[model samples]
Target: MNRIIAFLLLMTFCSCDFIEKKKVYSNDILDEELKTFNWNDVDEYPTFESCNSNLDNANKKKCFENTLRQILNDKLAKYEIIVSEEINDTVQLKITIDSQGTFVINNIVSNEVTQTEIPQLDSLLRKSLDSLPKIYPAIKRSQEVKTQFVFPVIIKIE
Candidate 1:
């Protein structure tokens, strides 16, 4: 009876270790699988109607920026506001394009002077953005995904 009890105790401890090791091994496998997945790269960058002319990623990005800049500059040129002091400021725009090719302005960040002097800055930006034609959303692994863009608009008042 004593020998049999000792044998049963040993089996219980060994079985517990085996079960623990199996759980640990399973978790390690999951971690390894996740590491192998590519999470950083998108198959295609976001594109504007005018940018679609270039199939190259770098060229597409440049075209998108230039097109957006031209449109915004044209709209901003309509406003003639003189600041008290010579000032150079940057307006940060956070824009998001949804998978359905809808543009959403996430946020606009600017200096106090820009906001105070140009109270209509936000609305003006919205209007400029609204004038943009439909955009093609970014693609990740053959699936269209919502992408966010942070663009800076430089404001110089002398």
Candidate 2:
């Protein structure tokens, strides 16, 4: 009876080893597959109409930034806001471009002074952003991906 019990225990242990081996092999295969996969990195950055002339990646990025800044500056100039005291503040705008090349305002961050002093600031900014032209969405491995961009506007009341 003792011999029978020992044989049964040995068989159970061997079956467990087989199950563990299968799991180990499957995990190894998955790891190897994961290493071969290409993760999401932008192959091409988002572009503006003015940036289309630049063929180089770095030049395209620079042109896009310059054009965007110019557009924002131009649009903001249309709004007339007066400050009683000379103040300096920075407004950070988080903008997102969807895969379909639609602009979406994610968030706007500013100091308390800007919020309180410039009551119409939010609406003005939104209007300025809404006036912008459509942008080309970023590409990741030939697939268009939604991208987020942060723009900081420095406001100085002289």
Candidate 3:
């Protein structure tokens, strides 16, 4: 009986060693996920306090954009920027909202004519963001994320 039990134990140990180890292809899975993920899209757009959070994604985005544009328009209107030459161009304002909900001007793209005519354009744009309302950072996969916007500001000065 002891000999039979010893033989069974040895067989069990040997058989266990022969079993294949399950390999985890985590890198491959990660690569596939990255390829399928949309890098430009966010789960939620950043919102201001006035924007209704319960609204649908499209409405929420529109509200946030309109609110921001309105605010910027109102602020810019206060400044009587005098340009030496009649200018009609658009300025592309690259604004970035960080994960901390802080607003910053990443870059200001303006025509040389516009820049020369209104040297204070950059400063004015920067100042407009200073009075922005409390913002909620964009959410992606339930995590706060930084977002960038290329806002076009039409400059029509006569």
Candidate 4:
């Protein structure tokens, strides 16, 4: 009987250890979440003062683009560019807005004909961007992030 009782006690303790074993927590969920997250997308687009912050994401982006287009058009309109030949081309402006809300021109894509026709066009665009209104930086994951995009400006001069 004594031997049987000792065997039973040993069995109980071993089974208790097996049943009470702690599970090791893992970060697999976090890793999966990070992998699934879209890094290229921003939660909020950059904005100007005239753009309403309460607007939805799509409208906010539209307002920002429209405001920038209008400002550039107005500035360019002030310059009386008279070309010798009829020129019709689209100049793609590669622009970047830094995390600090500063505007930067990465590149200006224009054909040689356009460049030759308007030598001061590049400088004029740069100056126009320099005089832009204060901008708000884009937001991603609740943090300010830099954004870049290409804006096409059509040049039509008779």
Candidate 5:
């Protein structure tokens, strides 16, 4: 499942322990520039969500559930097919999820110098990412405010 997240930052030389530690404080980029883009806006007050009536108890629950459902649905195939295996090799990857929820191949965070040694696994991992979708729905306040969320991906050996 994590394999599909191609934008994973890794350090092969570093232990999984380091990855765990860094997950908490290594890179600040995701914290600083991990911003959602709002291409254009109108001069007047917001009117988009005005008509989006508040979701009542049942509706609100559905609204939130639907958001997660949509994410899982979009990535289910990738989650199903792409495989990860524990090999004597490691690589780092930085994945970015756009406003639309597309996984961008940002950077390779690898402790391995040559991929030829683990070609088959490398190929399989990369192929799985093809199924990842970029459709992250922004959290709505009163119903409208799309923000960015950064999630880390780890291609664990299963």
Candidate 6:
């Protein structure tokens, strides 16, 4: 009985050693496969140094930032809800902006929690977009540049 038990243990250990490991990953798989299928955003950002390179004053940069912030806040203020509470949420809101500073929201990438979709969240996003003073100030070359901007929107329920 002892000899038979020892032989069975030895066979179990030896059988697994002959098995091969297979690789699941291949280059043929697209990068998007790793990300969620429902979401859409630019894979990267572009630099047009020629347009912004001419900005020589720190005041101008600050002005650009402040102006953009106020514009966004004013738009969001129109919502009567208690948005006084600040929070950060990332959803892809696609923005189209020309170098001249004209901007508009083209589309919004939303959460898929509801079957019919929530319109309140969408309305808030639209209002916030209309408030942007400018997409950006004229760059060094003064040529109109088209760029996609992603907005981080937060929604709170009370």
Clashing pairs in 2: none
Candidate 5, residues 1-44: lDDT per residue as tens digits? 57644335444444577556434564666555445533343112
Instruction: Give candidate 5 regions above 4 Å deviation.
Output: 1-90, 113-116, 120-122, 138-158
What C-alpha lDDT does candidate 1 achieve relative to the native structure?
0.83
**lDDT digits (tens) for residues 1-158 of candidate 4:** 99999999999988987789676556876888789888888999999989987899999999999999899999889999988999999999999999999999999999999999999999999988888889999999989899998999999999
Q: List the candidate 1 regions with Cα displacement exceeding 4 Å.
A: 1-34, 37-40
Query: What would the per-residue lDDT of candidate 3 be over residues 24-113, giving only the tens digit for each residue?
Result: 799989998889988798999999999988998788888988998898889999999887889999999898999999998899999999
In model 2, the Cα lDDT at residue 103 comes to 84
* lDDT, each prediction: 0.83, 0.81, 0.90, 0.92, 0.41, 0.54
State every prediction's TM-score relative to the real structure. Answer: 0.73, 0.73, 0.82, 0.81, 0.31, 0.43
Colliding pairs, model 3: none
Best by TM-score: 3
- What's the candidate order when arranged by decreasing TM-score? 3, 4, 1, 2, 6, 5
| Residue-level lDDT tens digits of model 2 in 1-158 | 99999999999988886777433588898899879765645677788876765477778777777887888789989877898766699889898889988888788898988888888888888888786776888887688989887878888877
3 or 5, greater by lDDT = 3
lDDT winner among the candidates?
4
Model 5: how large is the Cα RMSD against the reference? 26.7
In candidate 6, what are the lDDT values of residues 24-63, reduced to their tens digit?
A: 6665365646554433322222222232535545644445
Residue 63 in candidate 5, Cα distance off native in Å: 16
On a 0 to 100 scale, what is the lDDT of residue 133 in model 4?
A: 88
- Flag regions of model 2 displaced more than 4 Å: 1-41
Candidate with the larger lDDT of 2 and 3: 3
Better of 3 and 6 by lDDT: 3
lDDT of 5 at 22: 32
Which pairs clash (backbone N, Cα, C closer than 3 Å) in model 4? none
